[model samples]
Target: MSSAYDMIPVLSCENIDKEYVTERTWNGKTKTIFKAVENISLYINEGETLGIVGESGSGKSTIGDILGNLKSQTRGKVFYRGQDVAEMDEESFRKYRKNVQFIFQDPKGSMNPYYSVLEIIGEPLKMLGITDDEEVIERKVLGIMDKVGLSKSVLNKRPDSLSGGQCQRVAIARALVVRPEIIICDEPVSALDVSVQAQILNLLKDLQEEMDIAYLFISHDIGVVNYISNRIVVMNKGHIVEMGRANVVFANPKDEYTRKLVECSFVN
Candidate 1:
């Protein structure tokens, strides 16, 4: 629609497709190809929480992986601040990796069981050679833990000792520790209970406002997406079936596939 580069979105996906090929032995003569994502495209405005919704196989997480540069795409373009991600070199890509971080669905799995909360959060900083003073690292870690509702006491505890919500909070603190410009949340709250989900969502809102960070939130729950997202992107079969404002898309879906997803999520 708009061709002006100045008006370009903070993150835009153009014609993304991802596939995996594996050898199959039906008659020792064929192989199987699984296309996880088909030519999908979408855009996210600056500081906006763009929600990608669909069923489990709809390529939502794959899209996040592609945007975060965690996985290479078979085809497509991902523009971060108007520059194509596919063309980035090691130095440039490392910088891009810092700008775009991810929060996985299971914080327990994402975190190290052997590392303490403080160590887990500080690992990235250490890897980046930021090497701050002990006091400075403690101060920053505690401050971020406070921001995410994690207690300083748990800083010494292992992830296995903490509750699910607390572990997820630690993961959030780790993501925020980097002060990333964009965060790709892959089902960040789906594992928590409804009350905990609300708490996490509130934390995200507060942090987003305070830090001016953009979010690419991926979830299958339309109600949750409706509550947190400014705009919604409906995806199916590796394609962007529809896109619009969250309220409008949920209320008036233009695609049958999108409508079916909404119906299933809200029907109960």
Candidate 2:
């Protein structure tokens, strides 16, 4: 029989807290400690999309950064495949980084202005030492670009030259180039137009099915989150007030905050 340890989520955290200490009035005499995320625990199953929804300053992005390891929590443990991230050796951490990727909200701002689309997409391969051969990198970049529905004609173009939808597609291509096991998507489609948003969402859904990848999708829009996620986590003031299957959470939200969000989503 398999041990209980063998069934842990792909990525998870327990009672994680993130705090920032700053001067109250910039004079250095008075100080204030801000708790961006507090006592939050959550997980992402393999090949599943777990959506986290909250308003601005609700600490949703803070949790995403902590899970992505871009920022560390003040207290608590982060696990990857049931292994503690804090105790990982350099090689193990490198492996963790290779398996976890991020797709940010602003596609144009996330990319370098000078780099071509090919360069932007292939940069991760070089950073992770996946390959040094230009031909191999180009082939992989081209393949991923095609998979994300981008044409090869724009291979040498810069992010500034592309539309919002196209830039987001390039961002998706960059994240998928490494074939990561989990992707942290932080409001990835919120910057695009309504029509374009649906296209990108559909693309993400198709890619998830084809790649068998798990997603930690963080957004403030309940409607968007409900559409993409298999499970939902509702956050308010750095705490998860409710969590369950997507349909169930929306249909019967227990928390007042979650109900307000669901109501707002419907009204909008």
Q: Per-residue alpha-carbon lDDT of model 1 for 69-95, expressed as tens digits?
A: 888899889988778887877776767
For each candidate, give its TM-score against the true structure: 0.92, 0.95
Q: Using alpha carbons, what is the TM-score of model 2?
A: 0.95
| Reference-based lDDT, each prediction | 0.87, 0.93
Count of backbone clashes, every candidate in sequence: 0, 0
lDDT of residue 28 for candidate 2: 69
Best by TM-score: 2
- Regions more than 4 Å wrong, model 2: 1-6, 24-30
Off by over 4 Å in 1: 1-5, 24-30
